[model samples]
Target: MFTSAAMFFNGAEEAVEFQCPVQETGLTATIEELMSLLQEGNSNSNSGSPNSGSEGSNGRGVYSLDERKRRRMTSNRESARRSRWRKKRHLEDLTEEANRLKMENRELKNRLGLVAQKCYVTWRENERLESESLALWARLSDLNQVLVAMQTMRSQY
Candidate 1:
């Protein structure tokens, strides 16, 4: 446990040393190393304060409870806004699709009506032709009966 604490101290000293005459990558690496050391520091009790890990020392890169909470809140708000915008865009796309489908449905209905009208006219023409055919067959049957009677009278004479 004391070894961990000592490591944390050395890591923090290196972070502060790198801050002056700052090399960007060196400072970032040292700070990241320090945070990892502190997180590995399992103290007996977490006092829920920023300085709790370092025995109340004001260390570099330590986040206070309020700052952490504020950051989390801002992050959550940004996520929520992005989600709402995505939903709104999806709904708009659905609405446009529905409108297109409705227009297509109307066009199909009009085509069906035209097909029905054509079918009715064709049926009427077929009925007229059938009636004319029946009338012609009846006249031919009467003529055949008259010819048979005339031949019988001539044979009797």
Candidate 2:
């Protein structure tokens, strides 16, 4: 029974060796090499032999389809997470830009309002000055007419 248990543990260790270990950065160099060998073997011989090259495979590679799928899923998840973060950042930037533009627009409008008010006040002052000038001219003309009349009366005498 002790020998049987030891044999079982050895089998488990061997099974672990037969499969590829998942790596964070895509596939490991060893797995990539094995996958290439497997592809080559498949292309060369479709003999459908039960045993070809390695212990579990037919002299090809130790590349497992499930392992490839799992790695792809992990990579895709990471890519999606990055994409979401980028989109969120972009939205935040746009929002900040919009707020800045709105503030600028409001400031410009205020400045325009102030300028318009100053222009109206200036126009009113100009109208008042024009009226005052016209009145002064009329008074001067009346005084000149009175002096002319007196001169003519003196000449007649």
Candidate 3:
């Protein structure tokens, strides 16, 4: 009946190990579970035995009320500190991402402006070419008419 009690502190990979002398105790739990059980036992002992006050021993150890409260407060403070650090890191990540995106957007906008200018220049050139082509066609038509007139005069003579 080998029971393992693994207690992780602050999300660390290392665990606190505790060995029990009794083989059939069969107690496999974490530190949190042990703490909850102790608290429950403390409450029950206080309720059942009115003589047991804040400093009463619960056969395990002499964990006074003040000591338990202090430990709980310390744990809570550590948890809060870790939470704040995580939040700060998350905010920093978001800020960095926003700056990166802004830079990309600025670059894209500059590229779009350059492309629009090129398109405008090409459109102007196309219009100019079309106008020149129409003018050349008109000139060619006039030349053809003059040639026909000269041919008709020669035939009359």
Candidate 4:
């Protein structure tokens, strides 16, 4: 009865072996060499029997499709997290740029107002100088007429 049980266990082990394979990797490598082997095996099976390579194993070597799928899911989740972080950072940069532009616009407007005030002052000064010049010219003309009248009187004497 024990012999029969042992045979049954052996048969179950063989059946499980055909279904899946086990492989190992180092903690340092992020891209697993194990997954690459599984991919290659899948491709080779579709084409023909695989060539005997350096990664030697018994016929029908061990691998787990469910583990591969799980690894892919984890990688996808990490990629999505990174993408979300990048988008958030991009939005923050845009907001900062908009605030900077608004501040610059306000400063420019203030400078323009100052320039307008200075121009108004300059115009007023110019008008005052023009009026003073016209009055001086009129006074000079009256003095010239008086001098001519004096000269005429002296000629008569």
Candidate 5:
């Protein structure tokens, strides 16, 4: 089934990831296509003419099981290292964003407290001015009563 995939594709999908599957002969078509491309690429890359080792009549070099296992282990280790580095970078970014938000929140609370204090001071000043105005009006009324009494006594005389 994998060999048949070479007919539909030009063997350049090795770097691509597989997601959905298309069913043909009850087999996942994308997996078959990916495997075919990867195998072709591997065969092409390893086809260098080797003078130190025997080359088969098919122009391909023979590979040992130990060499294949070593390559697989190396690839796995590199992949794991990169994955760890990415996770660490992501955590650092999140921590920095949280710190910035906390600083902004603190500044806003301080400004709110200052505004509330100013409002209370203005209210107290207005209340003091209102009481002073009432006291002045009462004194003026008492002076008017004394003037009226003096005018009445002069008229009696």
Candidate 6:
């Protein structure tokens, strides 16, 4: 059982030999005690306690306090850099949209001016045609009266 427990921790298939006497009845209690001790050690290390060995010589495999702090600072700087890049990209997109909208507005205003000019020209032409039509109708009426008077004089003679 001790060999099995050690293999679980090691995550390997190679059989481990234990010299200590481990009874089946005490297995659960032993596992629990081991887990508690591991938790306590992790907490102490994270809290930078005196027993956690803040000195450069923490262990052969463990990182020193200064190294861990440097790694955390580097990760934070990278995260902040990425956030700033995203913000800059978003701002650039908004600026591009604003520029496009301004150009479109100017084009629409120019088209409106052209339409207004065309409408004024068409209105003046309509008014001139209407005045010419009235003048032609009055001339036709006077010519009809002259023709009727000539026919009456020819018939009397």
How close is each model in CA RMSD to the real structure? 9.5, 13.2, 12.7, 12.7, 14.3, 10.9
Per-residue lDDT of candidate 4, residues 1-157 (tens digit): 0110111112112211222233333432333344455555554433332232222344543334544467779999999999999999999999999999999999999999999999999999999989999998899999999999999999999
TM-score of each: 0.56, 0.57, 0.57, 0.54, 0.45, 0.54
Q: Model 3 has how many clashing residue pairs? A: 0
lDDT of 3: 0.67
TM-score: the better of candidates 1 and 2:
2
After superposition, the stretches of candidate 2 with alpha carbons farther than 4 Å from their true spots are: 1-62
Q: In candidate 5, what are the lDDT values of residues 16-119, reduced to their tens digit?
A: 33343345575576567676777676555444433223234465444445555677799999999999999999999989999998999999999998998998
Which ranges of candidate 1 are over 4 A from the true structure?
A: 1-61, 147-157
TM-score-best of 3 and 4: 3
What's the residue-level lDDT of 44 in candidate 1? 19
Query: Which candidate, 4 or 5, has the higher lDDT?
Result: 5
lDDT of 3 by residue, 4-80 (tens): 34332211222335553334543434544675575556444444332324333343433446556888899999999
* Alpha-carbon shift of residue 137 in model 5 (angstroms): 4.0
Scored by CA lDDT, what does every candidate get?
Answer: 0.64, 0.64, 0.67, 0.60, 0.65, 0.67
**What's the residue-level lDDT of 96 in candidate 5?**
93
Write the number of the candidate with greater TM-score, choosing between 4 and 5. Answer: 4
Better of 2 and 4 by lDDT: 2
lDDT of 1 at 132: 88
- Misplaced by over 4 Å in model 5 are 1-65, 140-157
**Over 4 Å off in model 6, which ranges?**
1-69
Error of 5 at 42 (Å): 14
Query: Which is the winner by TM-score between candidate 2 and candidate 5?
Result: 2
